[model samples]
Target: MSKIEKLLKKLCNPAYKQNVRKEELESILNHFFEGQWTFGEISGSHNYRIYHPYFKNFPEKFGPEGFLTIPVSGGKFIKHFYIKILCRFINEIKEIEK
Candidate 1:
């Protein structure tokens, strides 16, 4: 797995099963996805572009909702799984803030 994937999985794993405070989860989401804003460059950054795609391929393959409701059937399956978990974490954070 790539470094970015490893870190994302690590972050999302806690959010998925643990009871993290809303503030920390927001910090994690913003820092990892929005703050860094590059893919495969920074150690903990994901291409923010992944969530807002201008092109069709990302959405077509992963779905347009920015979260994987169903499984992604391909290589790098674990990374995609973490991405879904991350999206869910982000949503949960938003819900809590509201």
Candidate 2:
């Protein structure tokens, strides 16, 4: 009935899955860094580190290369972070449905 609910319903549709793929993720990151973006202003604005502990220790283990590594600390944290954000977003969508 509300605008948020309507938007969320659209996002929940299976057709939008393709937009959430890895390539789309990479494109978003690239666009963000290229534009010198910051946090706390996006649609899914949450402290990802709070939900994922590995992100907290990333800088210590990999230094500059930590974020670039895959399936380790950085990669795992990113994967988990994205999932959490997506879920949270979906929940918001559900709330709008109500």
Residue by residue across 1-98, what tens digits does model 2's lDDT show?
75544544454455444233344333433432234323334464432212122323456643533232222133223344443444454365347558
In order of appearance, the predictions have TM-scores of: 0.29, 0.26
Runs with alpha carbons beyond 4 Å of true place in candidate 1: 1-17, 35-62, 65-84, 87-98
Give the range of the ten consecutive residues with the poorest summed lDDT in model 2: 47-56
Error of 1 at 97 (Å): 30
In model 2, which regions exceed 4 Å deviation?
17-89, 92-98
Per-residue lDDT of candidate 1, residues 51-86 (tens digit) = 433222456555665432322223122233445555
- Residue pairs that clash (backbone atoms under 3 angstroms), model 2: none
Best by TM-score: 1
Top-lDDT structure, candidate number: 1
TM-score of 1: 0.29
